[model samples]
Target: MKKQQSQWTHREKSFSAFVTGPLLSFWRQRQERQFVGKEGVVIRYMRMTAAAHKKAILVVPGRSESYIKYPEVVWDLFNCGYDVFVIDHRGQGLSGRLLDDSQLGHVAQFSDYVDDLETLCELELSGSRYHQTFVLAHSMGGAIATLLSQRHPSLFTATALVAPMFGIVLPMPEWVVERILNWTATRPHLREGFAFGTGRWHATPFGINNLTHSRVRYQRNLRFYADQPELQLGGPTTHWVREAIFTGRYIESIAPELHHPVLLLQASEDQVVDNQAQDRFSLARNLAGFPCYGDHPQVMEGARHEILFEKDEIRAEALQKITEYFLTFNPNTV
Candidate 1:
């Protein structure tokens, strides 16, 4: 899709000054639910439905993210005429942890995340045939969504990914990283420990943060962790990192077979996931005649890794594109 003056001008008016009182009210409206995931772990998720029930959007968040940080996003999509659902993966958010230390982000296998999501769809979204369902995934959740879509192609109408983590922007070369991961494999003592340059959950100062430029949104999100310290998540484990790399390559290999259409939104100034990987995925989809991220390079100029929680101007543009893209699947409805 080309950037243009979308009909969703009202969305651009400004929800940046997101108030706590109203956000809290919106949070209260959601139905807190949980289900048994892979290995008998209890995974949590939230559901916020609009009265019309015309359409639905699944909000798949990035690493260290929780539903509590999505009041604004859920509010926007619901107002735009769709119900919203958000899942907390096995090792993060409100879900159960694999390791004893709640701060360590460890998982037995990445497929467990994909399996838990598929189970949720089979259960709570049992009547999903009544309306079209779309996915809004970001960062690590992006990989999980990709796996889910490939496994169940007919489950969702379409998918929109924001800053999807197709690959990680590592601190060192891939060869070196692979060697390090291999070394960890031989040492059980280091396998479950935090990766280099990461540790217990702590707030990064907004001025030097690489996630987003919106200080207000940044500070507001920090408060959520402060108010509920249990929601705080630290770095990833060596096992998790190994799984992520394996899953990412697998997704790229299978991109050409993805049945549903995808709209990927990239952050130009991202210091997180590899942009080149996103491009490769888009190219792979296009090879199979699927419409992927249009006119690459700078999808969102000067934006950081957090596109959904970006400044008003950047976030508004992203929301507009997503609204238009999802509607393309059923143009005559809503």
Candidate 2:
């Protein structure tokens, strides 16, 4: 099928060029709307299509994220000859907020996200006429995708995880600290807040400076932040951290049950999730005779937490590798 290039304004072009290199060879306009779930929660998504494409890739964003934060990724997937659908996780982006008061953005459990994804897949993507459907998730979204793959293996053809938050790289005493914090957060007087090392609430110009390979790419992301101040999200609360710990443990225990083909992309220099834990999980899955654990697992050197938002060349290469893997596994569809 032939692909068409979507028009972009000068500002948008500058933004895309700064983040994606010279010019985007394959770009498409996106349509945004809400995918209603059970219990009246609306999951917001942005979808882009290629002409005559029969396969679709559903992208799940991480914590404090919105669909607009992933323009580069959406464009790349469109170029790769597949329809791309990006969903804003519940309590983030344009989705339903968790807390009504000051804690509106905070989540009490990671399983809540898993439930949202399950509903999104079954109710949203199940009836679509695409020949093949897959999921591509990053960080926290990666964790949810892993859980979803285990819980609903038949819904997706495969999954690609970028810097998935399977576990944390904390000091030995950190576990004790987390337990104490969790207990304390339940107190009547103590208000819940984020844990240590999470990013600040204010969007700083320097936030992506150190993590990205290109200054222009970082600047472009900064511009997006400047334009959309409301999309900024704070760190996880104490309850969120506690729930994440439990979720990580649960996923680890059930890793053997996942039968869907999985591609795990680990950043060698990731400061967020524990890369060692991801490696160990992959190794254990191989040793335990898991069918889909041996799929291509690559650790990109000098990459940070946000692989999709990295420098133009680096991000493009990473996306290429992902698209290649997807096409190789399911060539009959794409």
Candidate 3:
């Protein structure tokens, strides 16, 4: 706790030497569990527990992501001496798919994610005693996690949001996109169909992919989907987009009302979510005399949407910040 975890460098090792070998091995050792989510959906999640641990960290992954994509993250946090929990949100990961087409990502309501998460915590952690509990969420999960914190004022001690999906980076203005989505969201077929230019899951080439600059990490992620097609997740449905947009606005509207502290890390080169919305959330909270951790959204320059899985340097920085922040709430950190 006195010193920060060092940022990993690309010079460290090759793919098989690290990711496929140790990371994969560690990932398989996690306890796999499931519970019935809203509407009979089977929600799955993973947990790494320590007998004498006094702290716990729950990881909330982004849209189109699974706990399978987070072994490295779980390993890192677990080594930091805290229990780690990662959930596969409904409609993605090993969880039950809402739509008939398993690839298409859709949710009945954004709040359902929050509901499932709360239920999971109640079923799993309610009986445990962890002095400091923290939430590390990314993208859409960030929105979900925030809403969870809002509903239960004392569930978590603090939260870390990495490139949260406060708003989607649309081609046109917000009002125009809103009008279009709203008109179609109520329709039966169109509402559940793929939104705009998106479609079923496909492997985006490394060169053209905007997710991460780290070829190693990106390729490893692709390896997961290629090996197990069940893990592949595609674009969001029209209803999903509608829910996300409206929920993002509501999150900003209630930014000042969050009871627990939050650390919002924004990616400078992120092309998925609108940074301006993050700014608005941070500003709103600060103006209300309740600022986010570090007083504003922390911007990680040259980073893409997936900071936790970005290049070594960027990912390391994010991990260090997250580790330090969670440790700050630990009475024995020193």
Best by TM-score: 3
Model 2 regions lying over 4 Å from their true place: 1-28, 36-39, 100-105, 188-191, 196-200, 207-210, 291-296, 332-334
Which residue window of length 10 is worst by lDDT in model 3? 2-11
After superposition on all CA atoms, what RMSD does each candidate show versus the true structure? 3.0, 4.3, 1.6
How big is the RMSD of model 3? 1.6
> Candidate 3 — number of clashing residue pairs?
0
lDDT of 2 by residue, 57-104 (tens): 889887777887777677657666678888888767777766553323
152-199: candidate 3 lDDT, tens digit per residue: 978988999999999998878878888989899779798899988899
How far off is residue 229 in model 3, in Å? 0.8
Minimal lDDT window, size 10, model 2: 1-10
What is the Cα-based lDDT of residue 178 in candidate 3? 84
Q: Score every model by TM-score.
A: 0.93, 0.85, 0.96
Over 4 Å off, model 1: 1-17, 293-298
Rate residue 72 of model 2 by lDDT: 69
Instruction: Supply every candidate's count of residue pairs whose N, Cα or C atoms clash at under 3 angstroms.
Output: 0, 0, 0
